[model samples]
Target: MRRRNVLRACLILLAASQLPSPAQAEQIIRMSTTYTTADSGLLAYLLPMFEKRTGAEVKVVITGTGKALELAKHGEVDVSLTHARPAEDKLVAEGYGVKRHDVMYNDFILVGPANDPAGIKGGKDVIAAMKKIIAGKARFVSRGDNSGTDLIEKAYWKQIGDRPQAPAYISAGAGMGEALTMAADKEAYALTDRATFAAYKAKTGLVVAVEGDPKMFNPYGIIAVNPAKYPGVNYKGATQLIDWITSDEGQRAIAAFRVAGQQVFFPSAKVGR
Candidate 1:
C-alpha cells in the first residue's frame, strides 16, 4: 500500500479512539524515546498504527537517553526505543530490562565549526583527532548526559588518555539538538548521530569533521522491562509492542520512512523477501 493510504487509515482508526468503549480506553502503552516524535513525520503514522492494531494507546514521553533509561530502571514506562548500546547493556545486565533486540543503525559524526581550527576534518583516526582537539585546547562541547553518544564520547576520551581542556569542555546535560545548538553558538566540536545531526545541520552551521572510523557506528536497540523485576509491569503489552515493531509489518513501515527523500535510519529488521 502507498504511504498516504496507510497513514490515512491510521488517522481514521485513531480518530475512532475518542469514542472507544471502556475496554478500549483501558488499553494503553506508554512508550519512551530519546528523540521526540516530532523529529520524524513517520511518528504521525506510527503512534496510530500501533494503537489501532493492538487497542493499546501509546503515551509518548520525550527525554534524554539517560532519563529514558532511568524511567525504565524505575518501571515508569512500558516500552523504550533508544540508540545507546552501553547503557542498554547495563540496564539488561542489572535485570531492569529484557527482550533486547537490535532495531536500527546509524553513524555518528564528529562535527565542528567550519573554521577547521583543529584540522580534524581529514584525520584517519577519531581518537587521534580528538587528542588534537584537546591539545589545541579548542572548545569541545559534550552531551554529558549518559546518552549513547555521550557513552561513546567518554569511551573515546579514555582511548586518548587525556582530558580536553577541563574548563573548555562544556557538558550540556540536554538533548542532542540542544547540544548541537550550543556547539554552534560556541563554534565548538561535538559528536552526534548522523540522523539527528543531519536533521539540524543546516540551521546549526556545524560541519562534519570526522567520520567512517569504524568506531563511530551507532546502533539502536529496543526492549521491555523485565516483569519479574517489577510485578506491576505490563509485560504482556510490552511483548505485544516489541513483536509488532519487529514484525514484517512494522519493519516495512520503518524502511519506508524518509525525510526529504533521504533515509535516515536503515531498518535492521528487513521486511519479507
Candidate 2:
C-alpha cells in the first residue's frame, strides 16, 4: 500500500511536469499595425517591454493602414494601430472598434533623388511641390496600397486637381519601404512618413523635397476590437495593450524612439487617459 501510494504520487508529478507551465502559457494578443510603425522599428523597441510587464505577447500583423483596419473589422486581430484619423474614426463609428486612443504622430514628407528633378527641394508647401512635380513630368512613385501615406498622397493630388500621367506616375502597390526603394531605383519622387523616411534614408539615398505642411500632419491611434461584435476576440488583452500604450510609460517610449539620431515619432497621447 505504501508502494501503491508512492507510485500514484509519482504518476501525478509526471502529469503535472508534462503540463504547460504558467510562463509557457503566456497570452497572445494579435495586433494589426501599419507598415511604417513596423518598418520604423517602433514595435521592436516597445513590444518587449509590454510583454515583460504583462506576460502577454503581441503578435504583430504588419500591413498598410487600410488593411490593418480591415483586419480589425474582420475580427482577425485583437487590436489595430494605424494612422489616418478619418478611417480610424469611421472604424469606431461603425462599431468595429471599442475606442480610438491617440498614440503618436509623424508627418509625411515628399522625398526624391538628391538632384531634385522637380525643383521643389526644401519646399514647405506640399501641394505646390506636387504641382511642380506634375508640371515637370518628374517620375513619381505611388504606394497605391491604400496605406495612410497613399491616402494622404491621393488627397494631395485631389487638391491639386491633377496627377502625373503614367510612366511619369508609377503605382507600386507596395508597402512604404518597398515604395521608397522603388522611388530610389527609379529616381522618382515619393510621399512617405517622416519616421519611415528617416529609417530608410541611408539605404535609399532619397532627400526630403517637401515637408512642414499642416496638411501633412500624420497621427496614429490604437483601437481595441469590439468584443460585442467579435465575442471570441481577445478584447481584454486588446484593452490592456491599448491602455498600456497610452499610458505615461508608453508615451515616454514613443518619445524616446529615434532613427538616425532624430526623434521620428512624437507622443500624442492625452494626459489622464
Candidate 3:
C-alpha cells in the first residue's frame, strides 16, 4: 500500500502535459531512453513506424540510460532502450526486466584532435591505444556520469593496471553530445558512440582516431520492465512494444537508419557484434 502511494506520486510528478488529453482518442506509451541521438537514432525510426502502424501516441522520457533503467525499475515508464550490456544483463538476470532483444550496434571510437597528440590513431589493440592516451597524459575528456560510456571507460581503465590519479583528467558529468562538444572545445580526446559522433562530428570538429577494435563495439538492447517485479508496469503493452522492435520491420528500420549517407549503426540481430 505504501509502495503503491509512492508509485502514484512519482507518476503524478513526472506526468507530462504532452500526455494525451482525455478527449484525444490517443494511446500513450511512456518510453524511457538514454540522452542519446535516440532523438535521431532509434526513436527517429521505430516511434514513427509504431505510431503509424498502431495509431498510438508514444510519450518519451529522454535521460541517461541509467536513469531510463531506473524509471523501468520503478514502473515509472513502460520501456527502456539502453546500450549498457552488463547493466542490462544484471537487470534481466535479477528479474527486473524481461524479453531481451538486440536492436542495433555501433562501435565506440576514440576521438581526438586532428593532430592526434596521443598517437592513439591506428592502434588495433584497444588496451594499447588506451595506454598510449594515459602515457601521453594528453587531455582526455570523460563523461564520468556513471553513464554507459562512463561505465565502459572505467572498465577499460580497470583492465589496465594502475591509472594516474584523475587530476588533469577532465570529467564532464554531461551527456554524450555535450561531452563531445567539451572535448572539441578543449581540442582533447573523448570516447563516443559512432552514431552520435557521426551525427555531431561536423558541428564539433573532432576526428575519430581509434576505431574497428573489437572492444569498441557498442550494442543496444531493449527490455520491458518485468511486471512481476513492479506490478504497476504495463506488461501487455510492454510486451507488444518489445515484440515489434525485435521483428523484421523494426530490425530493418534500424539497419536503414543513416545520417548524411553514412551508415553509422548496423543491425546486430541475426549475428553477434
Most lDDT-accurate candidate: 2
lDDT of 3 by residue, 146-259 (tens): 778888888898999745356547899888888999999888888888888887889988988888889888888888888888776666666777677777777778778887
TM-score of each candidate?
A: 0.83, 0.91, 0.86
Estimate, for each residue in 110-220, the C-alpha lDDT of model 2 and write its tens digit.
Answer: 999999988999899999999999999999999999999999999999988999999999999999999999999999999999998999999999999998999899999
Measured by TM-score, how close is model 1 to the native structure? 0.83
Off by over 4 Å in 1: 1-26, 36-45, 270-273
Task: Say which prediction, candidate 1 or candidate 2, comes out ahead on lDDT.
Answer: 2
Task: Single out the weakest 10-residue window by summed lDDT for candidate 2.
Answer: 19-28
Q: By the lDDT metric, which is better: model 2 or model 3?
A: 2
Which ranges of candidate 2 are over 4 A from the true structure?
1-26
Per-residue alpha-carbon lDDT of candidate 1 for residues 193-259, written as tens digits (9 for 90 to 100): 7777777888999999998889988777777988888877677777888888778888777777776
Task: Provide the lDDT at 124 for model 1.
Answer: 58
Ranked by TM-score, the better of candidates 1 and 3 is 3
